[model samples]
Target: MLSLFLFQISLNRMIKTLSATNYSIEIGPLTESSFQDLLTNKYAHSRKVIMVDENTHDNCLEFLLTAFDDLTDAEVILLPAGEENKVMEVCFQVWNALSDYGIGRNDLVINLGGGVVTDMGGFIAAVFKRGVDFVNIPTSLLGMVDASIGGKTGIDLGAFKNQLGVFKDPVAIFIDPSFLHSLPENEVWNGFAEILKHSLIADSSLWAKIKNYRNIDDLYTADLIEAGISIKLKTLLNDPFEKGERKLLNFGHTIGHAIEGCMLETDSPVSHGHAVAIGLLLESQLSNNRGILSNEEFKEIEETIKALYSPIELDEEQIAIVLELMKNDKKNSEGKIKGILIHSIGHCTFDEVFEEEEIRKIL
Candidate 1:
C-alpha cells in the first residue's frame, strides 16, 4: 500500500519544460530525492552558493538545505527583503561577496527567494566572473509564475523600476508549491495579478475560470499556475525581447509600475499586484474610451478588479507625477509613450502611442 501511494504521488506531479532562445525552464516539484539527483548528477564538483532574503532565510532555507546532503557545504548569502532593497548597492554587495568567496565562473548560484532575490541574484550571477550558471527556486507566487521564468534580470535605478538589467536565463527553475504555503496572503495576491494579466492578454478560457473564483485562495491549484506559465512561455517563444507580442504581457505594468514607484516613495508601500490591479482598471477605461473594448466587458473587468483590490484615490497632482514616471519607462520609443491596450478579453494591442493630453484626460 505504501509503495502504491508513493507511485501515485509521483504520477500526480505536473512537470513542464519551456524552451527559450538559449535555455529552458523546468517546472515541477523540488523534492529531496529530485534535488539530490540534481546535485549528484549536475553539480557534484562545482562550488555552490544559495541566495535568500531575510524572510525566506528564516522560513524556506531549511527545506532546501535538508533536500540534499551535497548542499551542506554550499555558501549562503542573505539579502534584505522587499523591493526597496533591489538596487545597485545591493548588487555591489553581492558582487563583492562573490569576489571575496572566490566564486568562479564554474560555480553555481541557487536563488531561493521571491522576485526581489531572484532578480538581484540572477543579475549578480550574470555579471560575476562574466556570467556563472544560476538556478531559481521561487518561494513567492509572483516569482514562481512570472519573475522566475523570464530571462530578464535587473536592479532599479533610483525611483525607476528595472531600469538596469540583462537577459540571462537560469540553468534550471525548480518550482515547489510547498514554498507558497509560507507566503503571506498579500504576497499570494501579489503574484495572482500577473496570472490575471496573462489571462487577460491571451486566454479567454482562463479569464472565465478566474472570474468565477470568489477569492484568491481558489486560484492556487497547480493547473491554474501551469496555465499562467504556458501563456508566458508561448509569448516568450514568439518574441523573447518584447519586439511584438511579448509586449502584450505588459498590459497593466506601464501605469501599474508608475503607481508602484510613487508609492515606494511614500510611507505606505503598495505591493506590485495591488498597483497592477489599479493599472488594469485605468487602462481598461482607456480601452473603452478608444472604442476597442466594449462597455460591458469593461464593466466586468472593472468590477472584478475592484472586488479584488480597493480603489486607490489619486489626485491630479499624483496623476501628474505618475505620468512623469511613465515617460521614463523602457517601453517608450522616440520620446513617445507606448502602452498595451486591450481590444477585448484575451486580445490586446501593444506599442500604441497616446498623446499627452489624451492620457491626462483618461487619468
Candidate 2:
C-alpha cells in the first residue's frame, strides 16, 4: 500500500521506531515528549551541519530548528533542488563549506530533505575527514520509505542513477510526516511507487490495500509506513552489501533506472516512481513468460499499476537507448543484466540473470 499519514497531528498516534542493523528509524512529530530530548542531549556540544534543498530550507527546516535548540548554532547549507544537482560538483561545494565552517569528525551532519539531499548528504559525511556521524530527517515519502532507510548513499554519474555511492548508515533517521505538506501532489505519488514496489516484492497485505485505493487521500496511516520500512530493513540487515537476498529490493530498479537515465536530457523527464512503475510492468510480464507468476496474478498487477500510472510508450529508438543504459547497471554480471523475478505478488526470487537477447525480446 502507498500508506501515508495525514498532515494533522494525531495525539493518540504515538511515536514509532523501526530498528535497522544499527540505526533506528523514528516516525513521529518533533516534540519534547518524543525522541527530541535524546537528540538534543546527545549532540548539545557538537558542531552541527544541516543540509537542505531550497524546498526543505523554506518549509521543513524551521520546524526542526524550532524543535531542537541543539541546532541553533548549526550551519545551514542549501543546495539547488532536483536530481540533476546531485553530482560531484555539488559535493565539492559542500565539502568546501564544511572546511570553511571548521567542521570535524565529532560534528554531526543532519540531512534534511528528499532523496537527493539524503543520498548526497550521507555521501558527503562518509567521505569528509574519513567519516563522520550524521542523521537523516527525510522530508519526502520517497526518502522516508526507501532512499533514507537502506544505508546506501549515492549520487548520479552523468545521466546514470546512483552510479557513485557508499554504504554508510546514518546515526539515526527521523521521519516526520508533517514534512509531506511541502510536496506537490505529483511528488507524493512518486514515493508511492516505492511503496508499491515493496508491496509487490514482499507484502501481499500491503498490495491488497494498495490496489483498492483509487485516490491517494484514501491511504493515510503511520503504521503502514513502518511496515514498508520494516520490509526493506529486514532484507537489508540480512544482506547489508547486496551479496544475496537484498537484490530482491531491486526488482523494478534495473530497468527503471535505465529509463530514468535515458530521460535525463529529454524535454520532460519521468519521475523515479513512474519509471519504476514501468519496470514493474515489464518485469512481471517477464515472470509470467518464464513460467513463474500466474497469468491471473500478472493481470491483477498490471490492472492495478495501469490504473494509477499512465503507460509510457517507448519508441524503438528509446528502447534501444534504455537497453544500452541497462548494460551499465551495477547488478549486471558475466555480461548479463541481473533482475529479480517474482513467483507471485508478494514473493520474488533474487539474482535472476538475463541475457541481452532475452531482455531485448521483452522490450
- Model 1: residue 24 alpha-carbon error in angstroms: 4.0
**Candidate 1 TM-score to native:** 0.93
Q: For residues 1-363, could you state the per-residue lDDT of candidate 2 as single tens digits? A: 111222233356566766544666778775623446545677667898999999999999898888777778889999899887889999999999999999999889999999999999999999999988888989888888899987899899987889898988888888887788778877887788888889999889889887766776643456667767878876776678888888989988888888888887787788888888888988998889988999999999889888888877678888899889988889888887888898998999877886667667877
Instruction: Give the lDDT of residue 56 in candidate 1.
Output: 100
- The per-model lDDT (C-alpha) reads 0.83, 0.83
Error of 2 at 149 (Å): 0.5
* Clashing residue pair totals per candidate (backbone < 3 A): 0, 1
Q: Estimate, for each residue in 10-70, the C-alpha lDDT of model 1 and write its tens digit.
A: 4344555544444545556677224556678777788999999999999999988986778
Once model 2 is optimally superposed onto the true structure by TM-score, how far is the C-alpha of residue 361 displaced, in angstroms? 4.0
Name the lDDT of candidate 1. 0.83
Residue 331's lDDT within candidate 2 is 89
Candidate 1 has which clashing residue pairs, if any? none
The residue pairs that clash in candidate 2, if any, are: 1-206
What value does the lDDT take at residue 84 in candidate 1?
90
TM agreement with the true structure for every prediction: 0.93, 0.93
